[model samples]
Target: MTTRARATVTVSWPEANTRRLARQHLAAPAPSASASASPAEAVGAMLGAHAQVLSAAELSVGLRGDGLTRTDVRAALWAEGTGESGRTTLVKTFGPRGTVHLLPVADLSLWTGALSAVPTGPNLFSKDARMTPDQVEAVVAAVGDALQGVELTVDELSDEVVARTGPWAGDLVMPAFQTMWPRWRQVLHLAGHRGALAYAPNRGRKATYTNPGCTPMPGPAALAALVERYLYAYGPATPAHFARWLAAPKRWAAEQFASSAASGAIEEVEFADEGSAWVVAGDTDFPDEPARGVRLLPYFDAFTIASHPRERLFPGTAYERALGGGQAGNYPVLLVDGTVAGVWHQRRSGRRIAVTVEPLKPLPAPRLRDLEEQVERVAAIMEGTAELTVGTVTVGPHA
Candidate 1:
């Protein structure tokens, strides 16, 4: 048999940054409103947006879309108006890294199927916690049945789960996020990732859960699809990056990458810092010039979370300022020429918003002007006025 060698391409840091900015819709302001006419279309381009903070997720989409408002994002999430008037095209669920995300409703099958395939290991529960496989399945089924045609808070659903299953389900508690989480409730997060459940509009200030109304794709096929989508949006990237992003085991992630490479679904590339990476096959084109502008990205924005080679994205003192303690999404980021330059936060009073930026280094006049324009856009999204302040400020976990 004849042997064929896979092709490899080299990309400089500047070129890679330009490609990422363009693909993520941060290269320049979108040319027309039609480019991102709807929330679903905007989110689909980036695969999915980080949504641990609902307001940040809304701003992520709003910033990408031309003339999109917070109201538009809310309408897509809740299906607010009459028939064909307010469409519920997006759903909130547990996604990559077991974190909350806003995914296109149409792609739930793929997301659920791929995420469910990740091997969580033998001891999924704590040593003291008692939860068998059958009991877990029962809890999952009870959650689905309880959520049918109705939305229930986590506490309410826990009650229903205990009723249908047993008190043992309620007794299994484990520590999480500085509090004890009932083991039965853990399945609820899995259920969302499995496409059996989704978040509904809150009642007053309480969060609610409901059925997502989609069938999950089979496990193996879904992983393959997810691999392709990840490469398209975040490559050229290493298997380790993909594994870390998904919170999946390194071996499984490597297997998926190898499988994709063998099939010519993705091709190897020479990345500036990573040495070797992979990008979607035949996707080698990049802009002639690097992206230039200032952007105020909200906490957990897709652009901040998805990019790899952290040093390149967060150069010099930016690493500590934007991602202190090695954690992403802790604070809003200031982007100068497609790189993290500082951290920021906003305070709202009636119809006005005051934005405080803490830059790692001094910014020139042009960059400062560009940042002012971004503040105006943020204020417009909130339907209020804005005031900008360039000075030191404490934000994020350590603060």
Candidate 2:
């Protein structure tokens, strides 16, 4: 029997960036203006938008989708208008890396099943407060039972959990996000990953939780599905990238990659500057040229976070100016020719948004014009008038 060798494609850094721009819908004349006609399709395109900062997530979708407004994003999230058609088709949940994200409701099962399949190390609370595997399962079940067709705040759900599962679930308090959370609340994170819980519309300023009706796939199958999706959206990547993106252990990510490779679900490719990486099988198509135009991407934009080879994406001084100390989401980014060229911030004053661009180097007249157009687009999405200001780059405390 003859074995056929897989074709090896050597991709240049420029070519890779071009492909990323087009695939991510940032290319000039932007691919299929209709690709983002709705929030669900836009979120689905990027796999899911980073939503730790809710407003940024709204901008993430608004910038991608045609004629989408902040109100439209809200409508999709809170289901504000009509019957089934009035309700938002997206769900807010703790997704990749245990961070909050907005995912298409239809894909919740896949996200949950794949995320729950990973074994997150030991409990970080006291031994007495730590939940045994069986106890954790019970807590998850209690969460599902408690949240069925009802919305409850984290505090309220904690009470229900203790009632259903016992006091151990409430005895542990863990430090998180500058506040103390019940040790059992960790299960809530797992519940999100297991398709058992999702975020509901906030009650005033307080957040509420609800149950998403989904039956998650088993671990291995879910993992495969996640790997395929990751490759499709951000591939020509390495196991380390996948691990970092998902906050999964390196060993597990490597195992998944190996399994996928063996099954021919993905193929190994040599990427420029980054060497060996994996791309989805038969996903070798590249655009004829690099994307043109400037974009003011909000904090934690998928393109800013998903792209690998940080050096290429944030070349030279851009590394420090746009992503100081290897941290992202501290500041909004300025993308020029598919690379991080600067960082920006917006200040709003009654019906007006002033966007200040701090470029690493002076932009040409043409690029400045493009930047102006981007600013206008942002203002329109924000439903406010906008003004552009250029200033010396300064990293903020957040940066």
Candidate 3:
């Protein structure tokens, strides 16, 4: 009789053991956690498995497990410890169309969720507020019309909005644009992806805007492709995760997930805690353990938000604060051996990035050593020169 081989169960080891597992299953180079190996092997192994070098945008949406932010997604990649020199994060767009997200390039595709345009409905532009949906839609139409052939800064756009909808519109004007403009940007951005519209600079940093640059329609096929890409990178996630990340309705996210599943393009996985998560196997893979390295993830890395059950990875009691407050919540974290050990932030001293880390629990000596070494490595990678003062500062009461 044929018998199934038992999957190796590692009940106990150094927390860094995850790195070794990642190297074995994901083909990453075994680091000091195991035998010595080249970082290139680790990088190549992951890329070869995925069949492409994932961008942050793609990974944030693709990994789609839960509890991910554009920042958390990139942080996970850096924790993997296999990327080009100085490639801490990959700059890309988040939900506000062009809102920049600095994702780790290597694991960028791991957090792909979903994206959709919410109609200017009551749920979004509430009638209870001073601005009604119709009013918001009017401003959106006016803004869309005004920028039909030209780009404008927020100031310039605000002026155009006033001219189109009239100044008496009051709060309706600004809030309307705030609520609707992002939707407009998403439509245009998606169109750009479909080769329909070419993106043009509407203004500079404080004066930025997107002008219609193409005639391509971001139709179902285009959106489907994009959504598929997101699921592939950040799969085994939930519709809610996609909805929050993409700033779309739960219905829209559900539709996208369903559509992908109908085509047999997406698969679902059951977490010990988080029920089931949707994923695109063709576009997804996970290391047996955790990604290596002691990466100090910026606020809200996708790794932290890939699934609702992140508590499984980093228990909530570990830290006293939820750095991420709302939908745009961000929390800088410290990743040791593929798990979040604590939250960290930097204090600027002239030209230094004095990183202060607060672990959920008192760090053991070995892990503390690992964190110090990792911080030194990151410092060398960052400003070419900087001092790392570990355990020099403390914040909040330890519960």
* Predicted model with the maximum TM-score: 1
Q: Candidate 3: deviation at residue 212, Å?
A: 5.9
Residue clash pairs of candidate 2:
76-88, 79-87, 79-88, 82-86
Show the colliding residue pairs in model 1. none
What tens-digit string does per-residue lDDT give for candidate 3 at 7-34? Answer: 2322222222343234323212213434
Worst 10 residues of 1 by lDDT: 28-37
lDDT, model 1 = 0.82
C-alpha lDDT (0 to 100) for residue 373 of candidate 2: 89
Total backbone collisions for each predicted model: 0, 4, 56
Q: After superposition, how far is residue 297 of candidate 2 from its true place, in Å?
A: 0.7
lDDT ranking from best candidate downward: 2, 1, 3
Question: Which residues of candidate 2, in runs, are more than 4 Å off?
Answer: 1-7, 30-35, 82-86, 126-129, 176-179, 393-399
RMSD of each: 2.2, 2.3, 10.1
Best by lDDT, which number?
2
- Tell me the RMSD of model 2 versus the true structure: 2.3
- Comparing 1 with 2 on lDDT, the higher-scoring candidate is 2
Per-candidate TM-scores read: 0.94, 0.93, 0.59
Please identify which of the two predictions, 2 or 3, would achieve the higher TM-score against the true structure.
Answer: 2
